[model samples]
Target chain A: MQHTDNFQEITHHHDYDREASRKEVIRVTVILTVITLVELALGFWLMSIHQELMRHFIKGLICIFMLAKAFYIVGYFMHLKHELRNMIMTIVVPLLLFVWFIIAFLADGNSYKNLRNKYDPHHVEESKTKVDKPVHGEEHGAKKEGAIE
Target chain B: MAQAVPAEQKWWSGGKSPFNVEYGKLMMWYFLMSDAFTFGAFLISYGTIRFSSNNWPDPNEVFQSFPGLGSGYPLAFVSLMTFILIISSVTMVLAVQAGHAMDKKSVIKYLIWTIIGGLAFLSCQAWEWTHLHHEGAWWGSNPFLNMDGTKASTNFTNFFFTITGFHGFHVFSGVIINIIMLIMTINDVFERRGHYLMIEKAGLYWHFVDLVWVFVFTCFYLI
Candidate 1:
């Protein structure tokens, strides 16, 4: 806590007051632990039961709790709560785009799956009409003839 | 009489760190934020494939194996891992606190505890990976199959390995960094500077690692 050193002289502008930060840390720790416990309880309960009512919202509930834990870690442990508004927004606003990316990809991938399942249950044949001469190469010709036997 | 410099002339027209944090701490936060998006991309992709598939492996059934007790306790082991990482975060906070108070002794003490917690979590992961590999799950195999005989296991196993393995690497690096911090504290490196911002930076990283695990746990195990 002494300002004898030059580094301390420059950056030691604040007193050694960590009491508030310390208390917040402990509180956040307790909160995170409690939230995790609730998630675990819900996890096991839902795992044991197949109630349609619970199933309707279980994924949403799990996600909500997960976000809560994420916020606590970022806001308190990482000390973004005490940071400048500009800084917070700088980090946060850009992340929204990431969420958008997930949604977009999900839509695109599902569309592809639908198309594949609907149009092609199996591989498509290259020819619409039987070839008069035969389409198989010599190796395929021998294998095809052998398979027919 | 000297003229004042133009507004744009100063490297930082400077009020404080743009985030009002130490330059190093702010940089650390930015680094963590970037790292987060990388993890975000991974988990989000995993979720996409999982939901798209007709039948996905039940995480509860998949992760039931526990050490010294084979395959009965669903999530019992990962819950322990979560607790350990959270506890390590707490210790890391205390270490940062001790650093601010210039209590180097307590800082080192708490850091050692943090490192121990990290090691314990890593050991659990190592065991989990080994067990899963033995149980016919690996990068190339996805033992879970959907009705039409299409194996959903391939994407599941591959994503599981890549995502969790990436996370495991972060935890490994975090432990190594914590060890370095511990060494510096013991050697009075921060003591000479008279501030513990170094510990705080390391704490941000360690907490970020835990935070990422929270999502990984939800995506991989809880869901």
Candidate 2:
């Protein structure tokens, strides 16, 4: 195989030596396609089995599928698979934590809504008792009738 | 300049570098990694809200714009857009291959095709957005239809806007970059400069835009 001059080689790494990056990109693309299909299938299955599952679980599953696709793209096609261990971790670990933070926040909000439903069933009469009667108008007339009765 | 000694001379072998890649390629990897995370965050937040809510509208039911057919045929328009984006990714691969073979003409042709593909995808998206906006489908406008119909949530609509809008922005910028790089290559600028790394890096960026669209089509439209 013919090689470029040394000066030309100095600036560009050409790590895959031409043939390899070409082959690697195709391989990575195929992997991405397959994973995408599986994720779509999983999404369909989730939606079909239970309406609640689709509402509650499908979103999380989509996130996981997206994360997987992102991993392969970065690792292979973007050539992160060829980078330093520390650099790879530096990029990935924090992203994982960031996603976790979002999930936790959403979960807490959901649980708080549930707890409010369970512990504090708001009642209309209890709320009405605290309202001050109007000094004038139909409501005040109604209050007078209540006082008479 | 003293540390300019070549780091790894083996060419194909592993390096002392942490991921065994050279600095330029490693940085590209890191940039892509961060970019992936940014996209992930947007899509995941979309998922969180849509999941937490009840009776969200199905994507297929909402984005049913058919291509070359009567208006409002579900998902046809966006499906065509998805196919166009995938084909653009193929063109990008061809450009990279031409770069590897040092074939300037082929590289320019493929890049031009890729740019066209990007533009076509953007136009489709613009149409879809306009149609949705015209239909009174503003974000978070009662995600459910009625008691008998599927419950609609604004969360779904909001995500449909934010994530897809951000991705559309990326594709727009990608086309601009491809055009610039194409012009430079055809003028023999890259050849004279003896640097095809820019072409390769730009190819990665372009592919990423394509990759994200694939997921968006599935999660946001198909599912």
Candidate 3:
């Protein structure tokens, strides 16, 4: 029953520290509540701002605040902060790929948007008068090829 | 005879270190990390579509209506829902503390509180979905592409349903597990086993749900 003894030893002070734990939980609750309210306020302010660049800056700030809240929840409540360093990295290092996922997928989607706009019917029809007709002509094609080379 | 039979106690078994955590507990952490990636994929796709589109849906306008408040409240209802989930996380941690102390009474009480908070969040989602339905934005209607009047992307709302619905299901399952733990606490199951690690396991899950909601609220409502 070595494992049983180990668990009991780990939980030994659990009773004596109940009050302290309560205070800690409440402290975290207050901090989270405050941050949430601040995020909401700043979000509304961003919404009201007309400048696009300024709004983007504020949105970035809001993301930072959200990340801070996440840090608190994971570290304190989930007890990850108390865990050993290797275990922490085992969880966090993999999550960095999320940032990569966002960038990679967003880049692909933006390219798709660009492709869609470039091949749009109106633009395609407009370009047909300027470039395609001459490119189909043998003389112009030959001349353009010679000039390019 | 009792004194002669006594043996020395030790924390580690002189074996392989399993992520510096107990086996069952570390596995839960690993499960949560994997779950986080799934949610990460969903949110990343959401951002992809959102940035790719010209006229993305306005979360403020879409989330304006609150029950009994009629309209004009932007993000207020969603904020309240987030608040409830955060506080529930608090209750859950408290329950874990109680379990560590072998205090069954406090465990039952806090678990009930957590369960209530989860139910409240689900109900709020129902009201929000109902409001959207009446406005012609049901599961079938694409919010972004449907330009009848609400300047939104069909892809946006479809992802919204898929992601939030999945998260809500997690919360649903969390509450169910909490209830089972509550019953077990009442039955002295942990007492017989000489520990309350089950409560800690449940706390891990509840906190993970809270953690995911933070991202969802940011991706869905704030950003």
Best by DockQ: 3
Q: What would the per-residue lDDT of candidate 1 be over residues B65-152, giving only the tens digit for each residue?
A: 8899877899999999999999999899898778878898899899999999999999999999988766666776645433233334
Cα RMSD (Å) between model 1 and the true structure? 9.8
- For candidate 3, the TM-score of chain A alone versus the native chain A is 0.69
Residues A1-149 of candidate 2: C-alpha lDDT, one tens digit per residue: 12234335444454537677677767767776677666656655654554655545775676677778767755565555654455667766866776576668668656654554466555222222333322222331121111000
Superposed Cα RMSD, model 3 = 11.3
Greater-DockQ candidate between 1 and 3? 3
Residue A118 miss distance in model 1 (angstroms): 2.4
| For every candidate, C-alpha RMSD to the true structure in Å | 9.8, 10.5, 11.3
Name the lDDT of candidate 3. Answer: 0.77
Poorest 10 consecutive residues of model 3 chain A by lDDT? A140-149
| TM-score-sorted candidate list, best first | 3, 1, 2
In candidate 1, which residue pairs clash? B142-B153
Q: Per-residue lDDT of B40-104 in model 2, one digit per residue for the tens?
A: 77866665554444334656556666546645555556656866876688678778777766789
DockQ of each: 0.19, 0.11, 0.20
The residue-by-residue lDDT of candidate 3 on B64-113, one tens digit each, is 88899898998889999999999899999998988878788888899999
Worst 10 residues of 2 chain B by lDDT: B142-151
All models: lDDT? 0.76, 0.65, 0.77
- Which stretch of 10 consecutive residues in model 2 chain A shows the poorest summed lDDT? A140-149
Question: In candidate 2, how many Å is residue A114 off?
Answer: 2.2
